[model samples]
Target: MSPEMTRKIFLYGAGGHAKVILELLEVNERRCAGIYDEYGAATQLLGYPVSGNLNDDYKAADSAMIIAVGNNAVRRKLARKLSANWATVIHPSANISSRCTIGNGTVVMAGVSVNSEVRIGDHVIINTNCSVDHDCVLANYVHISPNVALAGNVQVGEGTHVGIGATIIQGIKIGKWATIGAGSVIIRDVPDYAVVVGNPGRILRMNEPEDVAGK
Candidate 1:
């Protein structure tokens, strides 16, 4: 469908984060079809209806979606299961290079800078004021929180959460489902399901396997 014709959006997950995303969509004058969250028993969220749970029937609508769930792995799973042409929401103020590859259902928040040759996978959140340098590969469902700085050639695996104000040095590999604490400085590789904290990041806790997958 033509860009103009593709206007309606069904947002997944109705929570605090979804509210923010909805506000962004409204600022752009985009129509919200509804929301579908497994946890949304509430009739309305952000002045929009909770249509139903996300399923094949819900997926039939022509409207695209932005998966607003905070959990990276859940977002990734939802993105993979979504119907064709999942939506990418980029705030008007986001600075993204033409050479960057942003996948479907991703959101590039306001004031974010994505430099050249960056590959951002599906349902990712590049949050406010974050600076991603050149040659970064962010896998599906990654969330780079506000004010984070990722140097060049950084590889963030699927479902990783780089906390707000965190800094990652160049050429680092952050494994899947890893959680970096806010204000942490990560200078080395992070293992899967690890929670790292402090000035120079180190593993504080290892997440249970089920927690990583939401099982």
Candidate 2:
């Protein structure tokens, strides 16, 4: 597909986040093929019908999909099970630099700023108003929550979840499957599967196997 043209989108989750993505599609002037909820949570979302079974749903050959759920591990897991064209959704209000490289199936929400040489991987979420400064690297399935800020050259490993209002200083390396708590200030490196919280960001506990993978 051409860079200027957008394929019809099929959303995987019909929850509150899907509501925002729906509006984002509107702003982009792209059509939604359908909405899907694996748990059958709702019959419809904002007038869009929700498919009860993803396997049985009618899909367009040219359509693309965006996993609209918020959980990092859940998105990663579901992404592995489904095979289709991936859609990268970016809000029109976002300020992404020309030098930045974003991967497929990533969703960059409104008011976000991604600076020069930043590399964001597949199925990542740079949520509302987040700022990823120069040379930051976000691995696949990472979630940088609303209002989070990452200074220059910070490296977030795969499936890491940086909670709302968190701040990570420059040159920090956050490991895979790590969770940085809300409002925390991360001054140092975070290890894999560790859950950190508080002002200076101390490790609260190591997440159980199920915590990171949702097993």
Candidate 3:
């Protein structure tokens, strides 16, 4: 059996999103060795150890990690580089249909509801209270922010972020690395690297290369 079965999970960030993920671990009664941040941003988080380097608390074969950052692009970058095994955290309160498929390292936060035929890719985040309807396809590293509502057959591409309180109607397609701003109502398709905002979801700007996918 894999040594990772010992109940310890390692987090790869130290930030507000990390805090929320840490609590999810707590709620599930999982033990965390510490938080690993190469930048040395923090030394402690909610009483858990924060290490500048990935510590030797667990053996490499036993280390199960979850990218705790909120940024979709950064999460994708880290997922590609991090050699550790992954963990997917779904809050106990989340109502995810068994018919849906959630890839490794994904997180379904509290109060979230995912309907049947939904395909959520690796390291995606369905944030608190979000409603993902039937047949939605969420590509890798996508972040569906808190309170966002995705109607049936909606497709969100890689590293796309649907901001808090945003609503996308049925059959909408949002492209890679796109940003749908908070409270926006998406009525049409969004292209890659597009920054969309407002009630009618107008294109505000395009993201630079550094902030986009494959960066």
- The estimated TM-scores of all candidates read 0.90, 0.94, 0.94
How many residue pairs in model 2 have overlapping backbones? 0
Which lDDT tens digits does candidate 1 get at residues 1-215? 56734667778888888988998887777777778877667778866888656655435556677887888768767766766457788888989999999987888888999999999998889998999999999998889999999999999988889999999999999988889999999998999999999989999999886878665
lDDT: worst 10-residue window of model 1: 52-61
The lDDT values for all models are 0.85, 0.91, 0.90
Please report the TM-score between candidate 3 and the true structure.
Answer: 0.94
Candidate topping lDDT: 2
Residues 37-57, candidate 3: write the lDDT tens digits: 888578899988788876555
Q: In model 3, what are the clashing residue pairs, if there are any?
A: none
Q: Count the backbone clashes (under 3 Å) in each candidate.
A: 0, 0, 0
Off by over 4 Å in 1: 1-5, 53-61, 80-84
Give the lDDT ranking, best first: 2, 3, 1
Top-down TM-score ranking: 2, 3, 1
Off by more than 4 A, model 2: 1-4, 55-59
* Candidate 2 clash pair list: none
Model 3 residue 213 lDDT?
77
TM-score winner among the candidates? 2
